[model samples]
Target: MLKWLRPLVLLLLIGLLGIFGLRWTQQNMRNAIPSANSRVSPIILVPGSSATQERFDAMVNELNNKTKTTSSLLKVTVHTDNHLSYSGTFEPGRSHPYIVIAFENNDDGYSNIKKQAAWFNHAMTILSTRYHFNHFSAIGHSNGGLVLTRYLEKYFNQQKMRINTLMTIASPYNFSETNIDKRTQMLTDLIHDNKKIPSNLVMYSVAGTENYNNDGTVPFASVEAGKYIFQKQAKNYTQITVTGEDTTHHDLPQNGEIVSLIQQYVLHISDTKQRPDVNVRH
Candidate 1:
């Protein structure tokens, strides 16, 4: 009876530790950067792997606070819906220059690559018709990046729609054949078979170097080389490096350098038509 009780207590302790660790990580990861208070544009915040709309509130708030300049050129509104639904008017006066953010957890068992693409297409159509936003941009993290890429390959290739820029943070664009997930496989095939899903979208990828082995969740090769694959396939592409003290995949979004890099990218997109070049070494 004493031995059995000890084992039970150890198991309970381990479970508690696991739960606490997960919660701590999540708390650290949950953040938002609000569009700077100016005359910029409205942005739609998309979640990453296992992420919900609530997680992006911090980053949105930060973005809103930091982009305020005398020029008053950067005003942003945040739309937070997991299903990509928009409420109210999306007209020029109402909503323009929308930024779609894709995160990993949003792709659950029920939500696949194709479904996400359809949702994005629907959202783009509604915004384009109602708000006249011909040029749209997307920012995705991890698997969320994959979702956006897949969407571009499948739906936006033929349409006259314009994807101004695509920014991916620590995204896994490449995968090993032996350890490929179903969803990843689908995305890889779509990217490889460019003829099947041609696109002219500009892409930007960011990764770290210290943790070349694994950034907690994604390996270095997956994050760095993945963008190269897109560059090889597309005409316009660039990659940036943001090294953090943590250097873990989970910490990239929260790191100061990464946050600044992302803000600059967003600002560039808001101001001009051309994609800005960025390179953050170390």
Candidate 2:
């Protein structure tokens, strides 16, 4: 009986020690890599004016396929919606290295920028507040680029929202009719203003030239306007021109070659190849 008691006591002590060791190992791992819930910067994908949500879907899938990650393209169908707005999992979170939110406005994020920006404002504010996102990366195409510019003018550098990098694909910043408004004026003004906007922001203005020297939609100059607008801060400015094939203004989001350039700028892929058409003046 005494022999049995001693063995049982030894077994109990070993079990307790195993539990303690396991806990210690978990704590050490937690301290090293940080937790899964640790905050990460979000990438916001905005479609061009009058563009459909489906337009970005293939691109999103492509990004996932290329990176071998499960990063999701979160859809906010309505600007007024909040965290409860969309439903989906992190898709096993196995490949998800970061978060991507693709914003789709009911009004198509065009027609009227001031109003469209309002939707971006409401949605981003709620997301930042809810998720505690401190920094962001922005990508916009066509008039969607204008929306990002407006969003920065309103929210960036504020206590709530901040952006690190901005990419505008075939954006017509020189569109004649938009400058009459005060907000548009402010966007350009802020860029050139001496008060100084955030020094951390790096902007890429990407243009496309098709068969006829035009992007089949937006003129080459219109896309290049960003270089001038952000000229004073040249270090923060980059102008990229993707020419050839179906690399039209509308085809930019889907073009693999151009998307690789985007990967070079944003995702920082391993590709050593660089296209001559891309005039990266960073």
Pick the lDDT winner. Answer: 2
TM-score of 1: 0.61
lDDT of 2 by residue, 1-282 (tens): 997999999999999999999999988875442223325566777777667555567776777677666675666544434333554433323432333334444343234676666677766777666656666677888877877776676555444445667888888776533333323453465355523335557888888888544588777765666665566652488888777776977878878876776676776664565666867777
Estimate the lDDT of model 1: 0.56
Best by TM-score: 2
lDDT of 2 at 151: 67
lDDT for position 45 in model 2: 75
Which portions of model 1 miss their true places by more than 4 Å? 1-45, 69-105, 108-111, 157-159, 175-184, 195-200, 269-282
What lDDT is reached at residue 141 by model 2? Answer: 81
Q: What's each prediction's TM-score?
A: 0.61, 0.68
